[model samples]
Target: MKCWWEHLMHLPDDLSEMGVVLSRVNNSYTAASGEPVNTVQTVSSISNREVNSTDSEHSSVIPIQSKVCEPEEVLIPALPEVACMERGYVTPQQVYNLLNAEEGQPALYDPYYILVLDCRSADRYKDSHVVTARASVTVIHPALGCLISCIELQKYCIILLYAEYGCSPVGSVKARADAPDLQRCFFQLSDLGMDPVILLGGFSAFHALYPFLCTPRMVLVEPERHMLTIYPSEILEGALYQGSATQASDYRIIKNLHITHVVNATANCPNAFPNTLCYLRLRLTDDGQQDLVEALPLASRFINAALKADPAGRVLVHCSMGRSRSSALTLAFLMQHRQWSLLHALRWLKERRACTAPNLNFLRQLITYEEQLFGSRLTSLDDIRR
Candidate 1:
């Protein structure tokens, strides 16, 4: 949690004391000879004769609660209120910095959550935007739709909403006004484990405003007559970083495979390319992934092209580490193309790519997601192939 400064969004207002309680009791206490039992029991006691007035006329009793044991002490840091934003947003620079921060601060040392919502027209969302986006799509009203935002929150650490504000006509399905649905669409996202900072602002804010505010601990506020739309520029800034493993040894492998670009699966990576070679950041949140579930349709279009480019293009798909994310994506490709079943796809990836591993819990949920997709589409996995 130490490097949390890198991925947490700033609180719009300081509400630290609200909905929080902290208390401590020391080990020592003193009591008079004859004392009545009180509701609050005395934990410890110590006596000193210095203050005694050499007379029995008056006696004083100072009682204290239980003392904290030493050597083996309990340190319980408090958690924030249910509604307060705990983790921050992501950015491009943090990805690069994370790969090369000071020795004491390794990029992979800490784990952060990401939440992504698809506010785009329902159909367009079925395609793709940020690669790591989850698939928790529901309506603004809970009873009106099958999806729920709240449930998605239980699985991810951060959330991003991808909207198509002006892409469609005013009455069209994909207007920016669909923004508020992000909060309502999903099941209980406000539950215990959901992080607030990573909830991305309107799509435009992420695609446009973020790059400019890359410094950690800084905030950008859009002022209005009655309210303000504030963005946590720092978390996005610090979390951004360059693409995956840059060791010289890996360069040959990458070039041999003809990788043309790098797709960073974290919101923390820059959206644009750092150099002539194309690079993109897909600030994926677990919610978004829950929606899409599989990445093959997108990855095949992107990665296969790299493989077939004139000079040939190989691609590096990476998340915080080149593990779960890239691996899950690889599984998506197999599910879409190869005849392998979901279980087989995962097993093959793990066997061939040692670094390939999705969080076990995530994998379980993904299985359900895939089953739902298949259940709705093909009668079975076999039917999809034909």
Candidate 2:
């Protein structure tokens, strides 16, 4: 039976090749073919020349059976190996962070600009749906190519599609129970030479996790993203997050970051989730005259303990403003673990968070510590770019 998708969009329903969703992550827009998009004429013209050559010498006669019995060998062309989900599917937690700019992902600290396509029916969408998801009813689809062009799907860094029950892409390209909109959107992106991520477990799973984030309103003020933004700067990819007291106080930020350990470099800041998260609260202040040498061994021991407990665990370090104390502690940690010079560490910190400016005294202490560890003082605050 011809799939309904093949009828409407003239696309193959066999989504076996769809596993390339992870393999073909184009940071920018590019055709999947890796060539420029061409007109339908590029679809190989029907081969017209008939094969005339034949084994004429061997024809009209069968080879006599050899004394030794032998079996015929068969040859078959190899097919492409489907890529498994390495980082293809996005979880509800990750999606929330991607939109809010609070987790470890390609988006980093920036609020990921995304395009969300809701695959449910208009009525179902009207009831309530994921925040910032574009209802299928709101979209018009007279022409597929023109549709993507009108919406400028290429502009988004992340494109997400969700269904009602959240079926696997290999089994069902359609997003909802019986809707082609999701599959249509998938092909629309594929046609433009892009791969869109599927929301793991779909709306049902997402809403179950975060019911308050959904609403009946079809209008998106920001037009496809979360509202409130309070997240930490990713210092070391998925392993470490650096933030201020404000983010540390925000329970949402801590939970989303999956922070297993927290290094609190403040005398006044309370351990917000003491029962939940392990904290190494130093009796240090942001006065720039505090003793980091005394705190360094303690904090490093705490961090190493957590990693030993679970290597996949994540850690968060926060100070009053993530400027002086926290940044210094983070730098110290990097200097110890990453074997980076104070100069290199400062540059790396600033590259991720411009607010990372340890005070003059703190810089002196860091220089002294670096000199002790690596046997030389190689950096000054002046050497680092503003």
Best-matching candidate per lDDT: 2
TM-score, every prediction = 0.30, 0.48
Compared with the true structure, what per-residue lDDT tens digits does model 2 show for residues 1-386? 10000000111223222311111122221234443221111101112211111112222111222121111222121222233564457777566555444323224323236667787787888899876677753443536343545346566788787777665653353433354666676666666776788778878888876665667875454423334444777766567777878889888877766778888887776878766776666657766456666455345545545555534668888887777888888887777666678888887777667667788888888888776666666676677644
Task: Tell me how many clashing residue pairs each candidate has.
Answer: 61, 0
- Lowest lDDT 10-mer window, candidate 1? 1-10
Among these predicted structures, which one has the highest TM-score? 2
The total number of steric clashes, by the backbone 3 Å criterion, in model 2 comes to 0
Q: Estimate, for each residue in 1-386, the C-alpha lDDT of model 1 and write its tens digit.
A: 01000001111122222211111112121222222212121111111111111111132222221321111222222222223332343333332222123222231222223344555555555543433333445423345554534564455434444454423322235532454455444223444344332233434444353332122221112121112121111111222112233321244433433335655565454433343345433445433233222232344344444445565544566665555555565555454444345665555444334345566545654455344434422223333233
